[model samples]
Target chain A: MAAMTHTETDGKQGLLPAIPAGLRAAAPVTILLVLGFLAPLLTVAAYAFATPRSFDVFRSFTLANFSAIFDPSNTVWMSFAWSLAYASATVVLLAAIAYPIAYGLNRMFGKWSGLVGVLFVFPLFVSENVRLYGWVLFFIKNGVLDGGLKWLGFSGGPEVLYTPGIILFGMIYVYLPFMLFPMSLGIAMIPRDLVDAARDLGASRFMIWREVELPLAMPGILIGMLLTFVLGAGAIAEAKILGGQSVIPIAQDIEVAFTYAQNWPLGSALALLLVAIVSGLALYVLSKLDLDRILGKR
Target chain B: MMKISRRNMMQMMGAAAFAGPLASATRAFAAREKELNILCWEGYNSAEVLDPFRSSQGARVKAESLTNDPTMINRLRAGETRIWDLINVNNPWARKVMAPAGLIKPLPRAEFEPYFDTMLPEFKAPYRWAMSDDGKDLLGMAQRFGPYSFVVNTDKISKATAEEQGWDLFNDASLAGKYGVQESDDWNVFNIFLVAGINPFKEHTEEEFKAFAETAEKIFKGAKMVGDMASLNQALVSGEIDLYMTGGTYSVSPARADGYPNLRAITPLKGPIDGKGGISWIEITSTVNNPELSPLAIEFLKYVQDPEVSHTVAFAEGTFNPVSQMGDPKCFELFTKEELEAIQWDTLEEDMARSAEYDILPDYDKALELMTAAKRLRG
Candidate 1:
């Protein structure tokens, strides 16, 4: 009788909460998620079938908007290619730069690593657009970079601003912090004893890093790559401020579609295509990674 | 009565107290008739033009700046006609697009037609292009207008050379990456047409389009930076670019006011299209379809025709240009000699003659697509 009573009490505690309690706990987040995300997505999908003549989705429906995407000469394809290229470049470049810095900071700085980490994140405090504008001053012809070069005895230098290379540099510069923080957190999470054990076993520094640190920091690498890729892929201001006419990516094309073309259906379709692409890629990535481990469920 | 709690009773009392004033405020807002909401280009939103009328009539004027006509027309088509009281668009859009679309109301002849007598001689009569196809309704009243072409740093490239070279200047490989292009697709499309020796104002043959594409592709390749007026001007002043393609007095004269007096606009003397070298844009101010705002719109029409207000419109902040109202002696007197020189007013008449008015392109969409493709190709 005592065992039965204890089992029943555990079931009551674990399986169910009071109706009001359950609602109160979930209501705010549920409401926020519905309003913030689902509504906009449904609206975008509805608009994808809407024609420009009427804002009401029910008034008109056409597949022309989707068909327009297949235009052989459409600049959107070029823009999409640029988006992928830029995002991939930024992700790989940032991973290379961020990994070393993160490892060094955690290993070398010891207890002072927090302050050093804060210094790395200092640029994030300033607005992204402001920082991009600052880069403009440095990158433009006869700008700070060129002036510095001239002062260093070069008469003139090649144009740096509004080039493909400068845009790549800007992507790395702006998103480096996002990559660094996650990687450092991952590095710090690796127990100190593991490193000491590797050292006692006479493992080379490079060998220890390759075998021990790299595997341990996989979660951080995944997180860093995901954040950096998504942020850089959807970048508009950096492209506008630094890329100029030299770089016209899909974000700019979507902007032009809405603002200049006044074709909401077309713009919506284009936007949906972009969302599909990014989501597909993200899902593929998540499939490869052990997200449960990253979330601490494992 | 309903056995309200203390909190509920306080809320009810508060609501009762606020409802009276709120109702009165709503009534007062609807009753205020002396209001005008205008959508116009950059130069027309100046307080110097709007303040006098606002103070004189005890009215409020809300003005918004627009970069192009299609954007404003698109807004109206999207049900913004009820919000905007008056609109200013280029002549072709007012006639061919807005009027036909019923986005704008026909102007009352007695109220608006007389202003043309005081305007430039070209506007003195009912120009067919400014009227509906059947020629019955007058669509809009004309005001601020000028020949829009290219601007160059006169110290770097002399006006004589710029005028003489015409569209050929852009074709020169020596000037490659030395000029900046603004990303006004319509304007650039027309410019490419001019460069390709075809008149964009008329129907274009496929061969002509091919030529235009070639020219546009080449022009895009030659440009170092493509941006708006601000960026182009910065590049010009910073010695990054010597020429600003598709610029006009509207872009250069403002910089003159800011001490960059070396910047000057040039309208070429001849081009492939019947020897016409540049395009003149005339802005037409029209009342929206809102019947309630018609009276206020009429008052504004008369107000803008006043020479002082016209002068303010010409020298509106961010840009300065010669207004058609300058034909009036009163308006002409407001411009200083230096200001006239800054706007290249001495050569204005000659430039005007050399230029043809901008017209509606039958295949504007196709042109936009071509230009866009060319831009991408350049990228």
Candidate 2:
């Protein structure tokens, strides 16, 4: 059989047939995937080192883009510090609330949890503009909640959109679904006997949860919270339209460079730097937590 | 009094039918062998404008409005060759972004002809004009101009004096969070120069820079940062900001026409910041594939030059400016030619004479850094 296959391969001369068979069929799809996914990013990564030399000759091996972003004028240090804090807060709040809802529905309702799932996921179908606008209208002085508060005798028009508290509210609102989905899926993996086993041993509810539920559910909580945290970290439209410039996000820096400033090299550098830093943090977190084992598969 | 006449109204509805057909009947239009795909905004070539051009030239134009020039430039940079025959480009975006990206057709002066003469020395802005330097026929014709000035909500602003200007909206006792100005370097650089009382056309002293910085500090201290017309308009209409500065009327006209009752505008007594005379510059340029179709496009381009359609676009669609000197001063089919001229072209020279030139394009990167620094400093 091996000799027969070798004779056939020798006849073919190491090339696939011209028609859509074997290598010919897969060649186009592989080329397309590589071109679509890798080429643009490679071009941008190349720009991270782009610098003018003599007569339009560019020497593109420097780390200058990364250094420039960290320059004092970029104010990236302060902005990113604040962004991390904001994201962390959003993750905590979203996870704290989303866990109960996701876990309860998954446990109590079984297949009917799908209806709750639809309700949770439905807002994703709406445009970001619609979501932001709804929030903007909700937080203004004469807005729905404000009017209700006024009717209930809240006297002040307290610049709700401009406040940090309101920003926290918005970040949570946008990322809760991210938090909920991952968390619910995580909780589903836990065996029912673990909780029942804890309870039957005469442990109180708090003791059972602290020992059994929290540890098992941790991976989901971590992954879910991480997704929310990352999304919140780079959040732009929410802070831009609704945050009222009282607090400008670092993403706005990217906007100014790309759009109004038209300085793409700088923008690309800044953005790529952000990617590097964020990815570094993510890897750090994942390694520390051993997410591969937690997820059980890659 | 509705400002739309019957015959023109019928033509408009007819044009709408043309639009719906064009989207579905792409292959049939391809058979016309005369279809031009233009990437532009809603105001640049509304059906009212393109339909007449199509009927006359047998060349149909399909315009797709983009978010901004830089975004369009990126699309073009990605080798968007056959997608667009004409596009709207910003002054600096065309210079720093588009032209540098090698996304152009290298148009020369000989082809532009009479419209070539129409570009004044100043109107021949930085980057697009560079295309002409390559010794080839030019690609695009400028459609409308953008004028940057202060606009006041009539309900809030009672004065229009020069002293009332000087970035004092940041200091106005009644308006603190209620007034807005743009956050970009274009606005920041000009506002600083103006508040420092330096003329951009002339040199600046060390004292001027300090004064500029000081007043900028003052203005930004209490001022709200505005991103664009959408943000400014929302605030302006919702009574968030009663007065705003450093904006173009290209996006402001219809918002005013909406008859907020509180809506009003002023050129400001001293003139626009640094007298750079920012205006919404709507122009058209043909891509390489459509170079042969210039006759048809130029014909359509000439139609756009007509004060009639220009006025309708500016006054109704919020893309201000389609100006011509020879047209009847009061006889636009849409806006009286007088109204059209007012919105389209006058602010450039008037601002140049009254205020310092606003040089926001150069040192743009530095300006961004400064603006962010200023924002941080404010915090």
Candidate 3:
């Protein structure tokens, strides 16, 4: 039986053909995962336990770096909570805004969809920093928004720049397209015949969408949520530039440790903690949704 | 006959595609014997100053700007001393920290004393703070010194009014949301102490700490925006905010050079201690402890003291500041009347007299914690 199994696996192939096709196809990505992702993570983990003052990992190990995270004086807990909330809000907001736009673009623009798709991605051509600053020009007091409002005879407008709302708006603006494209692709892949069949069965358009289209788009929504959440959680620029010091996220605290405080070990510890939290959350959600079969389809 | 597999063939094609640029990049990193690596502030490495030195000495100059003294000192302590040939930092760090750490070596007094002869009388004598504590070694050469204080838009508020109000201007409840704060945590602590009527140069009592924290919270709350030096300048120019806290010639000069002379930095007339309301920073150029590069470092110091080089360093790319070599006739000639006025040179002497030298605050860790907590409360 063993001989038969081996023969079947190796039949009509070269020397390495006994290796499964799936493993062979995944070899490049596995190499990248080890070298690019795992190596840096191990380095950061090693540094997190280094002697704080000297920054020498081999000389000694200490927990002072990790202990600093709980020090109320640092207010790291507050910053962490702020970052989680900021990222959660951004993901929810982007998903809500992108779905309709993506759906309309995919379904309504049948012939011109290609051109309109380019327009959707046009903002990506400009860098994130430039795009954030563009928002700054529009949102700053007495800026373009205020000028236009005055021209429209509005008076005594509220200041928008340096507010928390503007920061979230900036994050949503930057991440909306990331959510849109994948959702659009997922929707387009839904068979036209399935929706037509639902309509022919005396189901209304709303029922067709609610029962069939939304379920089919789950993979794209999940992918979009993960991407937007990670990027938004790690973002430092939107808060620093648009929201000012009023919005001090965990990234800013990590930056202060490395730059101002000159404490690399503490920064590493905080960064690793943040990574653990984000990755754990993502894994939990993926497990619940069985993303393997869904996102794996693409 | 031998044949290459498809994977091997593609690998070879990829290698061939990247070979040229990879080879050139490797060649580009070849070490130069005469190359000088400088870690200093923005103005020290401007093209106008570095190009001349590079041309004259036939050397390559690689420079990196430092954000703060502690970070740079920590980098050197972590074994970067071998890589950097020169260090330019505020005098206190050079005298108290770097020299003591043996991260930098003493300068040759004979070679540098001549340049000191041409400097302002205050800098003519090797200041005690610019030397090793034992006073046997000249630890650094002074240049690019200025009174660093908050700046205001002269169009909205008169310089006289700002100077008279001094630190009190920021504490006013009526001024809430009328001004901005520069996002420098350490500097903000010093400013808070100044506003709270406590001298930061000494260790603070519990009461003083509480007062400083309260003052910081109030000031932060009053600010409409807290931004970096660049954004603070923009806010002032664009009328987003009328003034910014913790600004100086370093923040306003670039705007002035760009034709916005209305921005003005104010040195207050009175304070809690000795009636001095602002801090003055004197940047010192010192040689890193690299024996091989010490000669080039000293030569660069001499080159930098030249009038043209001094002017260039003073008005370097990001911001313009007044240099210590301003006493030199040639250096004085480099600044046009408008340029000097933009720097507020007319009141330069008075501003200097009214300012206290920038000193290392005692127990900075505690101050940093308290200030950070205060900032967190601003949310």
What's the TM-score of each model vs. the native?
0.85, 0.77, 0.88
Is candidate 1 or 3 superior in DockQ? 3
TM-scores of chain B alone in all candidate structures, in the order given = 0.90, 0.64, 0.90
Candidate 1's docking class is acceptable
Q: In candidate 3, list every pair of residues with a backbone clash.
A: none
Per residue, candidate 2 scores C-alpha lDDT tens digits across B1-379 of 6678886798789898899788768766454357666676567657766677788767767777765555566556545654665666544443344544545554445544455444444444332533443434354555544445566676666634422553545556566666666654555566555545555333455575566656666666666645456666666776667767665455455564454534544444453333433223434444434333333444555566565665555543544454431234442445654453444344445442443322224443444455566665544
**Mind giving the per-residue lDDT tens digits that candidate 1 earns over A1-298?**
6579789977876776655567768999989988998888888888888875256665678887777777775666888888888999999999999998998888888888888888888988999878887877776678888778888999866787777787888899999999998888788778789989999999999998888988888888888998998888787776666766787778877776666565677778888888888889888888988877776676
Query: What DockQ does model 2 achieve?
Result: 0.18
- For residues B143-197, write the lDDT of model 3, one tens digit per residue: 8888888999999989999999999888877778879888777777788899898
Q: What is the per-residue lDDT of model 2 for residues A125-195, given as tens digits with 9 covering 90 to 100?
A: 99876887788777665677677788889884566665456677778887888999878877886778989
Please give the distance, in angstroms, between residue B150's alpha carbon in candidate 3 and its true position after superposition.
0.9
Q: Against the true structure, whose lDDT is highest? A: 3
Docking quality category of candidate 2 according to DockQ thresholds? incorrect
lDDT of 3 by residue, A180-267 (tens): 8878867776778899999999999899989989888777778788888888888888887888777788898888877767778878
Candidate 1, position A195, lDDT: 87
| Model 3 whole-model lDDT (C-alpha atoms) | 0.82
C-alpha lDDT of residue A229 in model 3: 89
